[model samples]
Target chain A: MDDLWYSEYHTPHVRFSVKVSRQLHYEESKYQKISVFESPEFGRFLTLDGIMMLTERDEFIYHEVITHTAMAVNPEIKNILVIGAGDGGVVRELGKYQGIESIDVVEIDERVVEVCKEFLPQTSCGFEDERVHLHYQDGLKFVRHTDNLYDLIIVDSTDPFGPGEVLFTKEFYGNCYRALTEQGVLINQHESPFYEEDAKAMKSAHRRISHAFPMSFVYQAHIPTYPSGHWLFGFASKSLHPQRDLKADAWNALEIKTKYYNTELHQGAFGLPNYVKEMLKDE
Target chain B: MDDLWYSEYHTPHVRFSVKVSRQLHYEESKYQKISVFESPEFGRFLTLDGIMMLTERDEFIYHEVITHTAMAVNPEIKNILVIGAGDGGVVRELGKYQGIESIDVVEIDERVVEVCKEFLPQTSCGFEDERVHLHYQDGLKFVRHTDNLYDLIIVDSTDPFGPGEVLFTKEFYGNCYRALTEQGVLINQHESPFYEEDAKAMKSAHRRISHAFPMSFVYQAHIPTYPSGHWLFGFASKSLHPQRDLKADAWNALEIKTKYYNTELHQGAFGLPNYVKEMLKDE
Candidate 1:
């Protein structure tokens, strides 16, 4: 156990790893590789293709920010369409809201959902809620032709590669824009901005979202498990503003206890560094 | 060359590494082991006892925040004291200010200053400033018995272990408090609050500083090379509130161009997550 280390190369030049006490499960599904490991520091962590996804220790930060940021801004969001979050972290937070009417989850890999239910109960508990409807299919195709729509669309896919690669394309974003209500919000995993590759992906994603939506704002959060420990999320809407239209007063009245998300931090998260702002600006 | 990698264990169970082109320098100074490596992603990086200190790519984020956070709040700081930043990054930023009359840098290991000046000229350029004075001695001892007064004291020491363990002691904080002017400011490299061991150090340091200073506040930044990429800095003063007494208008008026440090982000940095606030709480 002393030498059992699970390593992932964040870049070709940079690697991050944790000491594994034991490997709980490992399998290759129809889409990609899935792994569940129990570690001393991060507790139980799930990885896809050897890339760290979520840990029992810090997944709250990612789950809360992704779900609550848009929910706070648009309290009128009656329906939520979650794309590619098979682990159920996003829905777990969404389930806390009594106002939301229904949640439609489109996950390409059903094995990820099944495995998470059996392993990561902390995040998978949301799957048990009756309000959540699960659909196993290609999210890209689902968005391309869907009669059923939502007021909020959350793109919680993996990196801009593999099966998740299609989710980042301008076509998928355009389809998502068409599938949403007139006044809808789009939130996606915008990747990290530190390494050259991740930064390229982040900027490209921002640009594509901008083309597909009337307004787009990129915000950041500290997720040490991710590459560079700095991760970005893109907020795009048809017409609503994240700040000027922020319903902080209403969100605060929910009294929903959160570890990371707050009205104050929601304001601060958009106050990104000048360098990051420069990178996001289109030349 | 294809397989060479420079690795550092952030915690007992976590390991981080960079693919190295070559080892630039490796030596055991009178104080500790000093090594430098060239990497494709991070550019050039310096390590002490296998701990990554700074990389050429992201050093600006650390150096800028460490100096500018205090500088923005108190622009009247003419005399300054820096402890243990032998890399000269702090002085490099401090040197940008035209009002800074004198800077006394007390680093225990002169070899670090020498090696940095020779190999890492990007950060070591400030050593050439005539207003800079280097005092090679134990910072704990120097602060305990210095008649020299400073308007601001920057504790840029390493982690609270080995040579740096003393700097985190209540005795050292008390000495720093005594060595400052009536309205002087104190800024220190407070450890991160993510990993168990680092969180323990960070909490203890905050407690010690709280005991010594009249006012103490903690702020965070994203530093990917560190243990968790979520790094923090301690800001303590006699009576100045970092937010209330914040001279944002004055700091903004300076028009000092920066890559990371900005007034809006400064105000936002103090908004900590609830989990972090709970960890920093005194029972």
Candidate 2:
């Protein structure tokens, strides 16, 4: 139609707008509203509840950082359970490692997968692999019910609002802890630290995850589509510390090519600013 | 005034906007259009030619990354030459170390310094320091004419466009190399790599700096007020390698309290992503 612009409220006083050439697709999914847009700069991008989920130009940074940080920490990790990664970006990155035997993706809404597979094949292409098992259900329930323990569990959920609210709670994190193997690692989409609401959510999630796992730390990546362009990921493990247990040589031996994640960056990402360090403190 | 929103074009198709409380000040300097705004989210911010220079909330990330990276690399740095840092953020950060004997700040436009002092004292406080010497003249000319040698040279100029364009050329970089002491370190504001225009500038600056100095590298910081929040800084020196010469223990001994720059991050910031590494490669 006309030159349409979509704006998202990064905070009450800040807004990020992208000029859309056209709306590629739009659907009211069971859990949230999913929309795909075509833009000249960012290429094609998907959004949930009017918030940017991933852009073709920058999704590699997010997915690679989230999936490979834990994988590099524990290269022997075979079984992976991804919750709320309906966009399939997380699973796509995990599929690169031949060592990963099984990948179980639990998405609350099936519509997201359907739309992504139709409109965003670059990310959804991983679903075609035989090792991936898609479970259409609530991730909170799936974690509680699954008797099979996982070597790694990735909470790739959306912002801590609407459909993704429960995933950031203490009960959900507790279930994730119980669902992990002896040396299991849990990585979650920790919120941004720039805005008030996001900082509050980031602190809450860190407190709960830190309580559940003996070791929990936060790392960051530059995701331009996100609120502050700075997005954080939580790394929690039973006995393996992200930095101390880091198998750098082992991960590098895999030769899995990545756009953003590297062994040095893996350790460096945990070197956060002093203010963010104060925000995630145990108090 | 009424409710007003400030918008900056990230790229041709992407826009970043903030709701402005009001325009603190605006002037058409001989070089460019300089404006200041008070925002609820980012606090007071300055703009040159409708592009964000820095914000009160996030200027620490930019200033810290640029100044402390070299300081940590060579803790004995006694004299510094700063070009085009009219806002005074870089000088303020450099003022922290007692070892820093003299700081010469060169600015093409005195209006930027005047406005920031009047409206943004948090960053402009460094101007009051007795050790800081301000020169209201072109940075390119300042570097070429100065017979004085400095241990550190900081090129905190705006994007490589319009008035700030000449500072990114090879001739200017050669002058920076000549104007430095034997163990001198030079840091320049290399633009982001996400947008096409910015990526071009980043590559151009890197190539020139690499040509001038024997050891040249690029580092990044997350500045949300900028185009993509992913900003790069160029580090070049004659004999000092940023990582190899990094005196983490020495820098930490100074005990300078900062919100963003720390020794660990100083090392981590140099860990460039693979994509960025590819971009900076000598083709």
Candidate 3:
């Protein structure tokens, strides 16, 4: 297929469809759409849920910032769980650390795994590694049975609608809290801070997560495909602040190519604006 | 009026219309279309040549970072020039200093000034100040007749199209270099770094600006209305780098109710990722 069609929620009733020269297929069982497009810079483009989610050029930034921030903070991160990471981008980032022995990825769509293996080979490299275990099931359902078994859990789902809507609720966060070890950490992708409604919803979700966990914070990144270009990620941990002192050797050991995330950016990302800091206060 | 209509250029051929609430009619004279709308949380919105541009919330972030960075570097600044700031937002930020003696505003469209005065009252507040001198002419033409005089020259034009296209060219930047004092500064609003095409264009523009000026750098801000949520501003100075020792008392003394610009942010704005720093390395 030369043409791919998809829709994004711009507002409450505003949905826009964009067409691009690519091949896209939807999996009924997973209710997820996987797309593949040829690009010069990143090699191949992978998108989910009708959005151009990640490209070959800068996937490391999103994956590393989300995973390492929590993992580095809690030193004893052995067993981890990644919820809804069908592309295996997070798993690829998580696999970099020798300390992480096993990682379980709960993806609603099995076709996403198949498509990633075929089209986005670079991101699918994690599946070949012995450390990662793939589980084809609902993330919310998987977490209920697995309690106090994980050191870190990352909710790498799409927008808070359809299959991901329950991921943003307090009940799911409570389940995630119970599924973690005493010093575990949880990170979820929050929407744009530019949209007042979305920001408020994300803030409310963060509040619920904070009530369940001891420490919670929000950080942002500039993602072109998302609405408002700026996207937020909420971090919650049982005992530690997200900011961890980077060992000189470990900081120098990162080998992945990234356009947005770096040792400097890792520090700057946690430094929030006074307004955003104020918004997250007393939560 | 309850319903207001305006268009935005996502791509060269892709134009989207935004329906707002209020509109100030500008008599058709020089430009194709000019109007101002009172948007929610976006502040005073300006539409020119059928393109919706400039929202209030983050406008100061762009203007302040561009102006203050250059101004802080220079020990002595007497005269300044602003090109295409129809709403006088940059001028408002410029007028914050008691040291600035005079400001000349060269705007091509008189309709934007009138619309801003009538509808976007807050943005037009700087025009009413006695220190500001408004001139109705093209910035390119205005700069050619001027000699080396201004301490600071800010090119606050829109994207590189329509009447604002010349502002992005090498010839215009050469003219600006000639129009500035021996130890002057020049700043322009470049496109976002998120989009590779726009980022390349901005890097090209930076290369041209570097040829005329001794030092050149690029910084970014998060503006939602723009194509990418992240926007870049290029800075060129003759004698000084854009870093300055900000006096907390002096900055706080300027009693401006700013939504974004602050002392800590001023320093933080220059902190770029390894990728951004790498992009500007050879340029």
User: Quick one: best DockQ, which candidate?
Assistant: 2
Q: Residue A282: error of model 1 in Å?
A: 3.4
Kindly indicate the candidate among 1 and 3 with the higher lDDT. Answer: 1
* Steric clash pairs (candidate 1): none
Residues B62-133 of candidate 1 have per-residue lDDT tens digits of 999999989988988899999999999999999998899999999999999999988899999989888999
Instruction: Report, to 2 decimal places, the DockQ of model 1.
Output: 0.78
- lDDT tens digits, residue span A1-283, model 2: 5888989998878889998989999988767888999987788999999889999889999999999999998999999899988888898899998889999999999999999999899999979888999999999999999999899999999888898989999999999999999899999999888778988999999998988999999999988899888889999989899998899999999999998889998888998988889898743
- The ten-residue window of minimal lDDT in model 2 chain A covers A274-283
In the range A1-283, model 1's lDDT, one tens digit per residue, is: 5579999888888999889999999999989999999999899999998788899989999999999999999987999899999999999999989999999999999999999999999999989888899999999999888987789999999998899999999899999899888889999989998899999999999999999999999988999899999999999999889888889999999898899988878888887888998899861
Ranking by lDDT: 1, 2, 3
| 2 against 3, candidate with superior DockQ | 2
True contacts kept of 2: 0.81
Q: What is the TM-score of chain B alone in each candidate?
A: 0.98, 0.98, 0.86
Model 3: how far residue B234 lies from native, Å: 1.6
lDDT at position B88, candidate 1: 92
Between the candidate structures 1 and 3, which one is better when assessed by DockQ? 1
Q: Go through the candidates in order and give each one's C-alpha lDDT.
A: 0.91, 0.90, 0.72
